[model samples]
Target: MRNNLISGLIFSFFLGMSWLTKADLYDATLAYQNEEFTLAFSKFSRLAQLGNADAMYNLGVMYLYGQGTEQSAANAFAWFSLAKEFGIAEAFQTAQLVLQQSNDQSGLKDFLKLQKSRLSNTYLLDSTLTKLKQHSTTPTLSKTHDVLPEYPDEAVRQGIEGWVWLEFDIDQSGKATNIEVIDSYPRHVFTASLLNAVEKWRYTGSKQAHTLIYHFATHKDEQYRETLAIQKKAYEKQLRQNIDAAERGVAQVQYYIANWLSMKEYNAYQLLRYHWRSDEPMNELYLAAAKNGLDLAQYRLATQLINAGAHQLGVLWLEHAAQTMDIAKYRLATVLLNTGEPQDVPHALQVLIEASNNGHLRATLLLVNTYLTRLSDKAQAKAWLRHGLIIDPEHPELLLLLARLAENQAEAKKLASQALKSASQRNWSSHAIHLFLQKLAN
Candidate 1:
């Protein structure tokens, strides 16, 4: 009778512990939903290390956002893969996204192998043993897994999988302008899929065209094999040749610094500063240029000084530059914001408004947020939010904030529901939705 009583007490204690864990997880989820990512990250990471698959998935998301830790796609992949091994569907999707962003396939393969091995050992007492074994046997090849789509002929193998490297030119609009395979392994079968996948890739827009390289690999059988090695080699050669040709096309921009140093041309000082590295020599050059009364050079020197945290000295140069250059005004505004002095806010706001009007998205977002949330000016905030919606309707923060601003409860609920749906699609935190569902059920 005493043994039975002791056993009952032990069971009750365990049950209570289980409930506490679940409650912690629920709280973490709520924090994540509210974008209190730091708290969410700490809670999720603790639970994850304790072997909670759901918590592992959430922790991976926090890493992706740089919440409690630095943003690391590799760490995110490792945690997501760990959760994926436990058969978490969300983790599986997140693992795939992390893999897509990763440039290192070998690292991912190592991580996946480690996770599988760990799971195999753990699952001896778990019901997921069979599923884990099945995952081990399946080939890592599918439409969703293949992010880059280009390969070399030699690396294309009809029945094998290996890595392929390719270089492509991305235009200012973020579209692939030209693609050429640099190298591949198991060359025959890999090239076709690589090319097909790469053609669909989109990049964030930049001011100038940029060159990028991607490495990808997959497993497939002979039916999809396509030989493109010779073609790839020839294309790479042509790309190099084009680069060499372009060097000859711009004589003024090329070696402009060398010419400026010899001629001591103050006008060429501004142009030279553009390509200068952040070193002592560059600093000396900038000082000389600033002394020569070049406003652009003064602005560049001020930026360097600000970055080095010599705020007082930087401000002196910036004030001089601001007399003639709009860029100097923008830089001064940024410095003021970072310093957080009450006296600087008005000037910062003025310069930020100018920059926003000139179509700087960063300045625009900052300005809008300041008006809406910080300053508490609802009318101005609403106007800014409406303008931002027109510019970027799909921005998550804006959508969520708008939902919160709805006049009636029904309207608020409807907008929140829609925003939550969109957030789910982006795999953003879903704690709020879960809570809302719980409330409805109760």
Candidate 2:
């Protein structure tokens, strides 16, 4: 039964993996390994057209290094972005590297905009719904354990609201299987939660396919909104007083105003509409608060400066902010690492450790990546990876990385199985891990 479950998980990774597709990918990988760039490029391109994630990543690499095609950062970014969407976690970091290393970013923004539209839930849903109209529907039986999806922290922080449409089959044992994301609003944010929750869902039936849409809202229903409107009216006096204090040079009030201004409209509520326009001059408020030694405002101002290309100023602000903000320390560490200075590496590692100690997940991951990739310290990397696992045991990326660095086949298998379980629960495409396990089994 355990073997069957593992086999089922492995089989899911090969959904669109026809014999021809498998052969082509192997040929492409072999050609690349043999330095036959042109043939490798051709084969990868063919597979990429058929929506192969690994092929897309390889194609991005080819474009990045001018292996068989003209070196094109734009093309590399587009392909890497697509590969990331298809669940290649490293592709996102690669895409960021492309941007950081590129001489010209002229068309990259436009390309990303185009990709966003193409990958949008609305766009994908229209095409998928058309296909579904031709197919017959299957009824869902009683649900035994339907876990409600948790809202993603990043999405909540960004005030992002979206929905995911999922399709999955319920096996004879009342377990959901063969889960797929049909579409998702804002694309990808809510998907992990939906997939993880759905994978645990059980139904009392033989075998059946079911479709579901899960909505993620930061707030409650329409009735809650109506109640919120009344509450906003009650808070109007306090809002006016806060604005008055901000204008009267109260640093805390200034920071509060800036923070409120920077928030999304949904997060800000309707009261903000009564006082400030959409184009509120929040930067000045942030600057004022930052100058007054407000750590939060300093962090906000630092990010704004960094985005606007004031690197030196941003770094100075971040340095100040880092003393109080874990996220600031993380950002500062990333900047130091990107600077590529030998002295900066130690400083970056120090700040990353500080951020990690404060329970910042990205900082921990960056520390692991830095030790493994940049510093060539696998021991340190392993230690940091273990720390991150403590924070998120089910994190597929961390698990997969640890699996790759496993000292022996037994360790590798143990880590890989954990990774496979996590990835399966989240419905993440994990062909590389699947293939690795298959090789080990052989």
Candidate 3:
């Protein structure tokens, strides 16, 4: 009788302990979601000490962001590395981002070396580390092997010498297409010729599609010849006019002036809203500043809206900031691809291609999605997957997509199995991937 009573008490004690453990995790998630970083950090730290991988990851994020603690990239990296040991893919990516942001290339090299030594038994880690090593050594710009085109006679005569910023798509076969001159000097003399020449440039075939930018600069003397003093004055006048047009209203003008003064989006939004009604035309000013071309305003507005739980609006502003034909476009495309609507998919693909062409790591993942789902071009899809693997051999999304393709061919059930394991490792929330894996298991 005493033994039975003791067993019941022991079972109850364990059950209560398990419930408390689950409650603490739930509370930590809620606190994190609510931006109560201090509370979340406290809970997560305890959980992490108890050997919870997810808690370790959450704590890493808190440290990375300086939430409830001083920002410490080193600590963030340490926790993320620990999480990676338990196969948290997001932690691995976060560690890479933290290293990049800190400009700690030496640390990144050391981390990779450590990973290579300690996790040599793990195939995924070994493969990923190998690709990272190879990428670290590769040059950003590839040498052009195609025949060079002669400079346009008109451009030469006009002495056009500044760089012509050209944007184009490079396919899997290394063929450049959809060439467009984004910005250029002596538009009439150089734009068309620059576009034409870039379109004809050939590359060695790559498994992944990338965007490439070629800068064509004329000689210094030629640049002077291209410059027209009066024309330059007129261009400056036009730019001021456009700026004025962008800030036409008193409220709008005030917002800009305040933003310039304070560099705070929330303050600008508050001032603008205080002076103008929500339904008024002046609201367009905020939207334009958020989306049209201003990146700082867009980022600020997006951050504010996200904090306020206006996810859709926040996403729209972030998309605008990300799509501004700038470096941040890659970051914006990543967020958009994760949260935006179906219409955002193609735009995300375009930004991903641009970023990938520029050698951005986050953009590579999007390239896989672009080919597989956005482009819906099977051959291109296969090519991009192969290319992504070159950069990140164990990328879960790439593996999952390839597995789905193989399932269609009925040639490799083993790929499907491996893909399921990879997807699970990454915590991918795709219903289709899940259903396919279930079918393969059956």
Candidate 4:
């Protein structure tokens, strides 16, 4: 009877302990997500002592980044070493990087002895992704072969599936270099795997930044397949209906069908077209609708004609749409610039200025660029950027341009800081700004 009672108490004690550990991990993760790094560090530290692999890894990250703690490579390396023994593969990967960066020869020699005198096959990717592109291609690097990564165990167990977006550079020697994960749908689920795989990829190209997406899925891919099938069916039905309407002489529907017909093969497939009519040429319908003074139809017809190198007809159609549309004015100016020679450069500048006056920021930027480069008028460029800043004080690109134009480093830094803040508010890409800031800081 006493043994039974003792057994019950022991079971209850372990159950409570398990629950507390789970709760602590949840809280730590929540704190990290909330950017409360100090609280995360505290919770994760407590959990790490309890032999939680995830907590150990998190602690390493906090120390490595100086988040909620002073940056200490030794501390991060120690945490990662502990986590690596706990079967967290990422910990081992990072510890490799620590060895490379450590200047203490005696410590590295001892560590190498412990690690069997050789670095592991896996690599430690750059933890910071914003500067990944710059790191990869500024100089030359060694070439490598393709090696696919294994699927993450935790993600597979949880039935989680998503993708990670990475940016890197191809070195002159054709190696994939300085790879970093810029975005991940499920955050940490596939980061390690994506990083490992990209590290081994080789590209035969000159030094340049490149971006790629890695998708992870198991059973969940079927769900996406089903959803896409339904979407395709719906799109096909709409296309058929539009064709019927177009045949009945509806100008809008005629434009829609004509536009679809004129689209490239890949784009038509994206619109769910299993087949296109080879016997039928419907550009005439587009021309008719454009001649009838529909702005969208005119734009579509203009692009179609322009792509075929019928410059005069394309410009004529663009002018017709430009009469009533801001987008048309921007497109016309862009086309004129791209085609060069035989273009009315002065008239195009007028069109851009008129478009900018209509609140088209793209036109403003283009005109500012033209003034800066084509005309070598910094005054006009500065005035335009200042005007844009007045309209939208937090306009990120304008602020970035202002930063670039600033002669004083202090003013440039301030403008870049404001640009980063503004971009973050809108969830816009701030990687370029980060690079600019990094360059200035250096």
Sorted on lDDT, highest at the top, how do the candidates line up? Answer: 2, 4, 3, 1
Give Cα distance to truth, residue 318, candidate 4, Å.
2.1
Worst 10 residues of 3 by lDDT: 124-133
Provide the overall lDDT of each model, using Cα atoms, as 2-decimal numbers: 0.52, 0.67, 0.52, 0.61
Q: State the lDDT of candidate 2 residue by residue for 230-301, as single tens digits.
A: 565545766788776665456666665655664454434355555655444465555555544567666655
Q: What digit string (tens of lDDT, one per residue) describes model 1 on residues 1-442?
A: 5335433433443233221123336567678779888887887765554345656666666676687779877777787778666456545655776687678977876876776565442343122222222332212112222263544434443222344444444433344433445344435456677667756655554211122323333223232334434344554454355334323322111212322332322223333344344433333434333432345555654554554555666676776666555556656676776686778878877876776566444455556766665567777666666676776666544565665566766776675677678655644444655565455446
If scored against the real structure, what TM-score would every candidate get?
Answer: 0.33, 0.46, 0.28, 0.40
The true-versus-predicted C-alpha distance at residue 123 of model 1, in Å, is 71
For residues 1-442, write the lDDT of model 4, one tens digit per residue.
5335433433443233322123335567678879999998997875554345556667777787788999877776776676676546655767656656778746754653454212121111101111222233223333456776666766654444556756555544455543445456566888888777766666656443254556665433444444544455665676677655554445565555454454443223334243434333455455444433456666665555554555565676677678777667877887777666545678778888888888766677778888887788899999998877765778777889899899999999999999999877754557779999999999
Ranking, TM-score, top scorer first: 2, 4, 1, 3
Better of 1 and 3 by lDDT: 3
Off by over 4 Å in 1: 1-279, 286-303, 316-331, 410-442
Q: How many residue pairs clash in each candidate?
A: 18, 0, 4, 0
Model 3 spans > 4 angstroms off? 1-300, 306-347, 359-362, 407-411, 423-434
Q: Give the distance in Å from residue 166's predicted Cα in candidate 1 to where it truly belongs.
A: 23
Number of the top-ranking candidate, with lDDT as the measure: 2
Worst 10 residues of 4 by lDDT: 121-130
- At residue 275, candidate 2 shows an lDDT of 64
Single out the weakest 10-residue window by summed lDDT for candidate 2: 122-131
